[model samples]
Target: MSILYYGLSNSSIDNCTDVDEKVKHHYLPVCYGTIFIIGVVGNITALLVYLVKVRPWKSSTIIMVNLVVTDLLFMICLPFLTYYYSQYDSWMLGIIMCRFTRFIFHFNLYGSILFLTCLAIFRYVAVVHPMHANSIKQKRWGTLACILCWAVAVAEISPIFNQIEMKLQDNKTYCFDLASNNPEFMWPYSWVLTVVGYLVPLVVVCLCYWRIMKELKKGPHKESKKRVRARRLIVLILTCFIVCFLPFHVLRALRIYTRLTPETNCMLDRWAHAAYIISRPIAAVNVILNLLLYTLSGDCFKQAFVEMFRCDRLVSKTKDIVKVAVISKPTTKITHDQSS
Candidate 1:
C-alpha cells in the first residue's frame, strides 16, 4: 500500500523510479511520521479514556474500544513502512516483518469493516429486536464478537502472504505485487478482495443501519437526545466509510480491468493512479475523524476529553481550596499542633 502511493504519484518522472530514494528523502518519512504521531496519540488517548475513565463499558463502547485498538495496531507498523519507503522500498526488515506488516494491514482493514458492520447490526438488533439485543449486550458477548471478527479478518487476509513477495528492480529491492505481472490471477484476486473486504460489508452496514434508523423513528427512544446523537454518529461513520473507501475501490477495479487487457490506455491508468493517490490520505483521515465524531457526539467522550486535557483542573483546585477553608476551625487542634 505504501509503495503503491509512492510509485503511482511519481510514476511520471523516469529518474525518480527508485522506490527507496523516493521514500527515504520524501514519501515514507512524511506519511509514516504523520500517521505515527496522530495515530499513536489519538488512539492511545481514546483507549485510555474508554478503559480507565469510562469503567462501566456498554456493548457500544466495547465496539468503539476495539476499533481504537485496531487502528493502533495499524499505526504501530507505520514506522517500518516509513523506513522502507525512506530506503526506497527496500525490505531490510527481513521477510518476517514484511509478511507480518502486510498481515496487520489487511487484518485492520477487514477487522475495521467487520466491526463497523457488527456495530450496525448491534444497532439494528437493539432497535428492531430489543429483547434479543438485551440478552447479548454483555461484555462477554462483545468479546466473543471481537474474537470472531479477528478470526475472520485473519482468514481473509491470509492470502496476502502468499501473493506478496520482494523483487529487485534496477538492483534496488522493493516489496510489491509479484502477482501484478500475472493479470489473470491479479484481476480475480482484486475483485474478490473488493467484494469480500469492502462491497459486501458495506452493503450489510448500510442495510442494517437503514433498518435500525427506521425502527428508531417508531420506537420509544426516538425522542431522546441520546438516540438523536446515536443516529448522527451512525450517519457520520457511514458517510466517512463511503467517502474514504469508494473511490479507492472503484479505481482499483478499474486498474485491474486495465491490467487484464492488452490494449494500453495510459490515460485511464493515469486517472486511476491519481484517484488511488488521493484515496490513500483519505484512509488516514478516516482514523482521525473518528476521534472528532466521538468527541462531538458522545457525552461520555466529551467529558473524558475535557478531563484528559485537564480543563477541569482549575475547578478541582478551587473545590479543594473551598474544602480546606470550610474544614478549618478556630479552636483546639490547630493551636495545639502549632504549640507542640
Candidate 2:
C-alpha cells in the first residue's frame, strides 16, 4: 500500500536512472522479518487473552480484539513481501496474488487506523459521559462499528486492486510495483486514502483523546485506576499516530506529488523513494508497538500471561507429586488395608 505507485513512467525510467533498488531490497527483508516475528507473537497472545481470559467482552475488549485482528492480518502478509524483496524484484505469484496482497495491505492499514479512532471515541464517551457510557459501551455497538470499518476499508481498496498491474522488467516480474498506467484513476484513489482514509481518522483520534484528557482532569474519577489507564492508553495511541502513521502519510503524499507532477525529476524521485523506504517500516512497526502499549496500559495483561503459565506449571508439578506418591506408597497401602 505504501509503495502502490513505486514505478517510473517510461520516459522517466529512461531519464532518471539513479535510484538504487539494492537499498530497498536489502533493508526491507530485515525490517519486515523482524516485524513478522514480533507482530505475530504479540498479536496472537493478545487475541488469546482477549478471547479466553477476558470474559463477557465489553466495548473496549471488542475493540482491542478487532485491532489485534487487523494487526495480525497485516502481519500475515509480511512474509510474502519479505520473499518478494529477497528475490530482488521477482514476483513469482502472478497478477491475482499481486492484487490480493495489495488489497489486504491497504485494508489492514486503514482498518487499524479506523479501529483505533473508534476506540478513542468509545473511551472518550465512556469516561466523559458516564451517564451515557452504557449507550456507547455496549458490545453490540462495538461489533457494528467494527463491521462498518471493515466494509469501508474493503470499499476503499477495491479500486486499487482493480488497477494493479504486473509489469515485466529486465526478465523479472514486478507485482503492483509499477506506477498505474492510468493517472486519472490513480490520483483520485490516492486522494481517497490520503484524505478520507488517513486524515479524517487522525483528526478524530486526536480530538477524542484531547477531550478525554480534559474531562479526566476535572472529573470525579480523576484519581481512579480506570482514569489512569485511560490516560495511559490515550498517550500510547497518540504516540503511535505521531511515530507510525504521521511519517507514512506525509511521505505518501510527497510520493504522490512527485510521481504525478510535471516537474518531477530523478532527484525528487530519489528523495521520495528514500524517505518512503524509511517511513514505511516505521508505519509497520505499529503492530509490534501495540504489544508494548498493551503491557504498559495496566497490569492486567501481564497478570493474565503470568496466570496462564503459572496454572500450567502448577498442574505439571501436581502430576509429578502424584506420580512419586504412587511409585513409593504401593506396598504400604496394601499392608494398611490388610490390618483394617
Candidate 3:
C-alpha cells in the first residue's frame, strides 16, 4: 500500500522528472531486494514452524499462520515492483501484472488488519470468558471466521480492480494511479481504507488488550502464567501495528488534505513522497515482526524448533536405550538358566 502511495504521489507531481532518476533506480532495487529476501525467509520459516512442527494447531496459531501466508504472498509480488522502479518509472510487466500486483498488495493490507483484529477478539474471548471460549473457538468456527475475514478483505479492496490502470507517457508505461488525480474519489477512498483497515481494527485491539490486562490483574497464580503470556502477545501486536502503520496512515491523511486544498506546495509533496517510500520498508518489517512475535509468544513454536533440530539426537538416544534393554534381558535369562 505504501509503495502504491509513493508511486501515486510521484505520478501526481509534475516536476518529478527534474529529480535524479538514477538515484531512484539504484535505491528501489536495493530496497526491494533487501525487503524481498528478508520478508520471504522470515515469513516462510514462520509458516513452516507453525504448520509442520507445531501440528495440532490452536486457533491463535491458525490465525498467525494465515497471517504469515498472506505476508509471504505479498512478498512474492515485490520483485515485479522492484523491476518497475528500477526501470525509472517504466513498467515492463503488462497491465494484468500491474492489476494483480496491486490486488495482492491491498489484499495483504486488508487481510492482515482483519486477521489481527480477529486475533485480538480471540484473545479477549479466551481470557474474558474462558469456559465459553472453548466452545466458540472450535475448528469449525475458526475456519468460518477465516473465511469471513478473506471475504471482507476481498470485498473492501475490490475497487482496485477497476481503479488501477497503466499510464503511458513519453513512450514509457508507468503503473500508477488513474484515479489519484481526482480528489473526489481519492480522499474518500483513502479515509475509508484508513478507517476500515487501521483505525477501527486498532481500537478493537486496544480495547481487547486493556480488558485482558485488567482481567489478568484479578486472576489467581496459575492463571497468571497464561495472563502474562497473553499480555506479552497483546503488547507485541499493539507495538507492531502502531509503529508500522501510524506513519503511513498519517501520510495518507496529509496527502488527502493537500489534495483537497487549493494551494499545492512542492516541498510538502516531496516530503509526502519520502514518507510514502519509507513506509513500504516499514510495512515489510512489520510482516517479519509477526514471525518473531510468534516465536516469542508461542510455546508450541519453541518446542517445535527444539524438536526439529534435535530429532536425530533423540532418535540415536532411543536406539541406544533399546539396545541396552535388550542386552540386559539376555543376561537376566542366562543368569536364571545357570541358577536352575
User: TM-score: which candidate is best?
Assistant: 2
Please provide TM-scores, in order, for all candidate models, with all chains considered together: 0.77, 0.82, 0.80
Clashing pairs in model 2? none
Question: Residues 61-96, candidate 1, lDDT per residue (tens digit)?
Answer: 777888898989888777887777677567776666
Off by over 4 Å in 2: 1-20, 177-182, 219-224, 296-300, 311-340
Error of 1 at 164 (Å): 0.4
lDDT scores in order: 0.69, 0.75, 0.73
Q: Which candidate achieves the best lDDT against the true structure?
A: 2
Clashing pairs in 3: none
Residue 180 local lDDT, model 1? 37
| lDDT, candidate 1, at 3 | 32
lDDT of 3 by residue, 1-340 (tens): 2223344444555654323244456766787788789889877777777767887776777777778888998997889988888777788878888888878877887788889888889878887898878765666666777888899999888888777777676788878632333456768887888898889999999999899888888836846656667777887888878887787777756765665554556566556555555565565567766776776555478778767678668878999999999999999999999999
TM-score of 2: 0.82
Tens digits of per-residue lDDT for model 2, 83-150: 99888768998788888877777777788888888888887787778898888867898899899888
Q: Rank the candidates by lDDT, best first.
A: 2, 3, 1
Alpha carbon lDDT at 66, candidate 3: 79
Give candidate 1 regions above 4 Å deviation.
1-29, 177-182, 219-224, 293-299, 314-340
